[model samples]
Target: MMHPLSMPELPSGIARVQFEPERVDYAAPEASGRQGGVQAGWPLWLATFELEKVDRDSADMWRGFIARLRGRQRLFLASDPTRLYPKAAPRGFAGMVRAGGGAFNGSAIAWAQNVDADGNADIGLTGLPEGLALSVGDFIGFKWDATGAAAGTYGRRTMARVVIPGVVSNAGAVTVGIEPPLDMLVVPAGAIAHLDRPACLMRQIPDRSSIGSIGTGGALSGAVLVAGQDLRP
Candidate 1:
């Protein structure tokens, strides 16, 4: 297996970052021509990194990073620039991830999918401070399995975005909606919800990546679209 490459943050950072879920399905044409579809694969993320227009040095730096990627031949770790922390006071729990500080015990103490044991969009996060809530669009990450193996988590870390708004209960638990449900083949267990540094393993789309001077002078504007590598547990 090829090792995944770690990429530096863009020199000029990103002018924009767009995220979308990629769902695959097979069309099941109905007798009356009303189309029905069967899901073909688990959901994954499609991302677009809009490189900011910048000075020659910055443009060159962008070229250097893109060049190292060699256009879709390698994998890199990427995350939503807008989702480094939750949208609330204190914002995150990584710093105080312990018995006294916060709920981040790191042993997957209290984490599981909600409503359905098999797997779904909703997940239950335990060990949070009472009334602590995650807003829609906030991100969380976790991976778990009965055997406590990466094999159950599609062999990699998975990041998910909250889709429904909710608050933690007095018991320090809350259930919220998430998109692109983590691929959990067996019942999920020994799980922990991460509120910091959520990221996706991605491959650049060669055809969609381009960079060069786009306006007057030596300034450059560029963009690249990366797709999450679909994995099955």
Candidate 2:
């Protein structure tokens, strides 16, 4: 099985993502009446995200995140919703985020309710109403709670190994059996967990809008920022 390239979670704010191909076609008179085409360039993938209430903290965080990128930094991007737990190849791509965008946005917030570290413990999670659609050998990202006493000793951020396939159990549980059986720290109750996937380095577009007024206080209300794949020949 082709494993996904381990990558950090996408910054919160992305509400939707899209993939597009950059191609060109031409016909050579001498070659015949048949038409041939070659890839104009690498495929272009775009991710759209929104900035919540637009608070100072959120705004600063977004600004810092982008500023740190310096417009051409390589970053991992995984926006495919269908292949959350890819079983075969084509796990994810490595690209650069196009520059020229100044839209401010934050990351998503999620947490797990309970966890166990037995031979193959089942973990329960919250904020995932649709449950998870995962396969064996997939990876799950976890951020240990800062307040947890063991946070200092154990790695705060780590990936969990998925031992079983299929969606989360009817009780909203997923089974994990860490490979190598290292003395892995148990993810305490209320820790954050997210789906993991391989990522390709991408460049952030420098063109973006300034912080704007907040819209309705609905869950879907926020600003949309776009990032494109940075292709290199």
Candidate 3:
């Protein structure tokens, strides 16, 4: 079996995707002899995406074939809808995704999807029991299956590590943001900064989950959009 990474050349129409968050100055101007202070706000998250054509034959064996070639891709978000609340995931949040066999072809490559917790995945921003409330020093850390979560199984799949620092903390019906800054797929670098013509349709599920269909808009907020397609050599 030829490894996708080992392939010397990809299909003619295929391309790679890449993206990075736009860097901004966190330091604020100072009234004294020191540098400026940082304004109280969240950093802008940037994600990039690309598209390319893949040989269906070779793609069938590619580790990323499923996510890059499958019918539709999914994205999940846990939020309070108020943009300032400690959000809780619905029952069996990650489990439901696992049951769907999220990626059909990628399983052989160990790209299967799995979450750490069995039921609801909750994020605590503060000890407050009322409306939404998070402290200024609080950080968003993943304690469940988030740690060591990768893409492949049996040494054939890819892995993804997702982490985010808490930029918003307040108590009063707040909504948490779940924008990831990276992708496990091998997309072109240009795809992360622009929007596609189709405008990619977004699907929201009851579990506070969302997914972007392929060839439509699989890339997320931080991801840029490129014209090339995924490749399979």
Sort by lDDT, best first: 1, 2, 3
Show where candidate 2 strays beyond 4 Å.
1-11, 24-36, 44-46, 50-59, 73-83, 86-195, 208-224, 231-233
Candidate 2 structure quality by residue, lDDT tens digits, 69-179: 555453434444434533532343223111222221111133332334443344443333233455665555544433434433322333444565545444444444432
Among these predicted structures, which one has the highest lDDT? Answer: 1
Cα-based lDDT at residue 199, candidate 2: 29
Residues 105-207 of candidate 3: C-alpha lDDT, one tens digit per residue:
1011111122235321223222222322233322232111122434331112111112322322233122232232223242222221110010111112222
Give the runs in model 3 whose Cα sits over 4 Å from its true position: 1-14, 19-27, 31-34, 37-39, 53-233
> In lDDT terms, how accurate is model 2?
0.40
Model number with the top TM-score:
1
TM-score of each: 0.76, 0.35, 0.21
lDDT of each: 0.66, 0.40, 0.24
Instruction: State the lDDT at 97 in candidate 2.
Output: 15
lDDT of 3: 0.24
> Which candidate do you rate higher for lDDT, 1 or 2?
1
